[model samples]
Target: MDYTAQILKNPIFKIVGEAADEMQVETYVIGGFVRDILLKRPSKDIDFVCVGSGIALAKTVASRLGNARVNVFKNFGTAMISYKDWELEFVGARRESYRKESRKPIVEDGTLEDDQNRRDFTINALAIGLSKHNFGKLIDSFDGLKDLKRKTLRTPLDPDVTFSDDPLRMMRAIRFATQLHFDIEPDTFDGIVKNADRIKIVSKERIADELNKIILADKPSYGFKLLFHSGLLKLIFPEMVDLHGVDIIDGKGHKDNFYHTLQVLDNTADRSKYLWLRWAAILHDIAKPATKRFDKKAGWTFHGHEDKGARMVPKIFRKLKLPLNDKMDYVQKLVRLHLRPIALVKENITDTAIRRLLFEAGDDIEDLMKLCKADVTSKNDVKVKKYLSNFKKVEKKMREVEEKDRVRNFQPPITGDEIIEAFNLRPGRVIGEIKEEIKEAILEGKIRNDKQEAWNYMLEVAQKKGVELN
Candidate 1:
């Protein structure tokens, strides 16, 4: 089928075709942009493959398009041009053969068919002709259009060969399935299962990238289930895989932390698009396996799982090559405090408790509440309703307290520096002790989280301490 009209709608398409014709290189728009076009998904990144020097074609195209700058990568024989909203990448069509030791391929100039053959999946191999004579003509030598119609993903060549050549393809298979909400062809998925260990040859950064895409899906659990069954999760993340099974003792069993984690992840994803919040859900109960114990009287208990899970975050992030900065910290904080609000539900709630939650949670109180609420993945509707209702009350109390006390992320109005000046004392443990006392007083509702009140309270405490102003 020809999409000539669609091709003509964007002037950049015509410019690219004319530039390719002038350079005398056969060119076609291929890979994701083509697939997304057919899927009616909006894409601003376009990959164009040409038979000859793609750099020359890109330079010519850029020159015609307001003398735009073309960024050329001589090592890869590729060029990129940013044209308005679209990022245009041009690469020469080439065939590749992989070495056993590495996923990097040996490249040689080849025809369009060769380039299409190298594509990871059938849907991604679809291409559209860009030259004047064959403008917008669809190319689907591997039945990519058929797979698209079936809403299934399959390897363009032999599935084993496709995945073995580039183990990252295994992760991409699951990522695509999750992102597109499509199914993997049975044979193709089996290939993933068989070649799952080969994913170790791929870098952690690449695997983490694909994992993040899966986590961001509308339903992340689907991707995780695929990863688990394929055995890829074990190879890539055994810590998470360890959460798989329920252990039984004395005729009692705990929930499968693996599937429970996935449920919470999906629940969090449904509420917000924040990737780290979903990650918080994943790790919130990660240490349950390590902390699991049977009390016989009280059934199964995962004591200190939250604290252990919070400690586990840095190692997991480091192993996965995830950012070790504030994003990791955010996930860690949420994991540690996930049960705090729920703990409040069963106990007698007080201003001190609310103030502590508000103070510890700070700006993330709402996100923490969301993760905690998502934590209640119960089969019983009444149980779920009760948990959610209690969470709502906790949220209400937090809001009211925040408005009244202005204590979300609030520091004690008294500062150590001020205390040092007030008492004419050196910076030491005494100052640290005083600051803690002030913060504690505010959090305990003895003071109103106000400067004057904290100052008055600090003076009283300092007087009791027998500190002399020098």
Candidate 2:
């Protein structure tokens, strides 16, 4: 199919073609840009593959565009140019063969067909001609177009050879299936299962990248289910796999925490797109297995699972090579406080309790409520309704407390400096004690969250402590 009209709509393609013609090398738009255009997905990055030096073509195109700047990677034989909002990458059409120990491939200049054969998936092997003779022709040597139409993910070559050479493709396969909502062709999926162990050779960062893409997809659980069944989850993340299974004692059993976590993940996805919050949902009950116990009276109990799960978050993040920054902290805090709202729902919803929760959750109170609401996964309609109604009451109480006390992320009206100056004392336990008391008083509604009330309370505490005023 000729995409001349489509190519003409964007003047950048014509400029690229003109540059390729001047360089006297065959060039084409290939990989994701071509695939996404056919799928009608919005894509900002475009890749060009040329028969000769792609770096030279990039320089030529950049020079022609005048204002565009080209960044060349000498080691990788590739170049990049950012024009307006679009990032264009240029690479030589080359074939690759990988060593057994590494996913890195040995590259050599080759024909377009050779380049296409090296692609990880057939759908990605589709290319659009950019030469003068065939300015917009579609090239599909591996029936990639047919597979694209059928929404199937298959390798351009033997699945075993493809996966063995580069194990990261295994993760990519699952990621694509999740993101595109496409089916992995049976053989390709079988290849992933057969070579699941090979994924250990892949770097944690790359695996994390693919996992993040899967999590960011509209239906993340689908990808995770595939990972679990295909044996990849066990190899990459055994902690999660440990959450599977139901143990029965005297015909009493607990729900499968693995599937339960997935349900929570999906529920969270339906309400919010924040990746870390979804991560918090996945890990909210991660320590249930560790904390699980059974009694004849209670059947089963996962006591302190929330606290244990919160402690496990940092270790898991370190293992996964995820950022050890505030994102990880957010997940940890959510995991630690996940059951707090439910506790409030179960018992009396009081202003004091609401103020404490608001102070702890701070600006993330809304997100925490979202997670707590999603945590309700009961199949019983009446039970679910009752829990939801109770949650609404908890939410109402939270809002009232927040508006009245302004305690969400609230700082004590009395500072340590003020306490030190007033008591004429050095920085010590006394100052911290005073601050804590003031914060506690505000949260407990004993004193208003105002400077005057806090100063008066501080004076009373100081007098009781027998500290001399300055």
Candidate 3:
């Protein structure tokens, strides 16, 4: 198939073809750019493969494009140049062989066919000719166009050979399926399950990169479900897999926290696209297995799972090599407070409770509420409706309380320093007690969240503590 018209339209392609001809080397646009164009997906990055030195081709192209700087990686035999918003990378076509213990390949320069054969998936093996002789002809030996038409992810070569050579491709296959909403060909999927254990050879950073792509997809639950079925989730994230089973006792069985968590994640995805919030949903019930207890009255209870789950976030993030900063903290905070909104819905929903929750949740109050709302996934539609209605009411109350109290990210009206200065006392337990009392008084509406009311409360507490105020 000739797509010469498309390639010729781009000014950079003309320069690439002219440069390749001058150098007497063959060049073609290969891999993702070609596949994405055929699939009608927008891609700004293009890959160019040459039978000769890719670095030399990149330099020549860069020179022809008015001395555009070429960034070369000699070790990988690849080079890149940035033109406007597009990134073009050039690499020498090569064949690869991998050992049993490692995913790193022994690379050697070869023909274009060798490079296409080394591609992880058929859809990514398509190449568009960039030579003047047959510019725009698509060379697709693996029937990648057919796979694209079928909306399937299939390996170009033998499934086991392809995946075992570089186990990270297994994760990429699933990730691409989730991103494009494409199906993994049956044999390829089976190969993934069989070689799931090989994923350990890949680095955590690379694994996390693929996992993040999956998490950011439209329906993240779909990717996670695929991971679970392929046995990859158990190895990569045992904590999530731990929430899988349900134990029965006395003819009463609790809902599978695993599936329930996925439902919440999907619900969160529907409402918002914040990656950390989605992570909070995935982890909100993560400690259910550890906290699972059976009582005579409460057949099965996961007491303090939220708290335990919250504590587990840092460790999990560390293990996965995810960011250990505020993003991790955000997930942790949401997990700890996910149950608080539900508790308020069941109880009297007092101003004091709402104020505390608002203060603790701070800027994430809205996200926390969204998560709590998504948590209402009962088979009973009426119960779900009731919970949703109550949540709306709670949300209204929260806004009112937030406006009245100004308690979100609220700082104490009376700082500990003020208490110490007012009471003529040093920094000690007595000052902390007074500050706590003042803060409690403000939150409980015993006094207004104002300086005068807080000062008076401070005096009262000091007086009760037998401390004289200046």
Q: Whole-model Cα lDDT per candidate?
A: 0.91, 0.92, 0.90
Task: Score every model by TM-score.
Answer: 0.98, 0.98, 0.95
Better of 1 and 2 by lDDT: 2
Instruction: Give a tens-digit lDDT track for model 1, residues 1-470.
Output: 44536754788888999988988889999999988888888999999999998898999998999899999999999999988899999999999999977999999999999999999999999888889888888889999889999999999899999999999999999999999999999999999999888898898999999999999999999999999999999999999999998788877988888988999998899889999999999899999989988897999999999999999999999999999999999999999999999989854689899999888888898899889888889999999999998888888888898889988978768888899899999889998888899889888888788889888888888888998654
Instruction: Candidate 3: list runs displaced more than 4 Å.
Output: 1-4, 423-426
Task: Indicate the TM-score of model 2.
Answer: 0.98
What would the C-alpha RMSD of candidate 3 be, to one decimal place? Answer: 1.8
Q: Would you list the rank order by TM-score, best first?
A: 1, 2, 3
**Candidate 2 residue pairs that clash:** none
- Candidate 2, after superposition: displacement of residue 183 in Å? 0.6
- Between which residue pairs do clashes occur in model 1? none
Residue by residue across 270-381, what tens digits does model 3's lDDT show? Answer: 9998989999999999999999999978799988989998999999999999999999999999999999988888557789999889888999999999999999999899
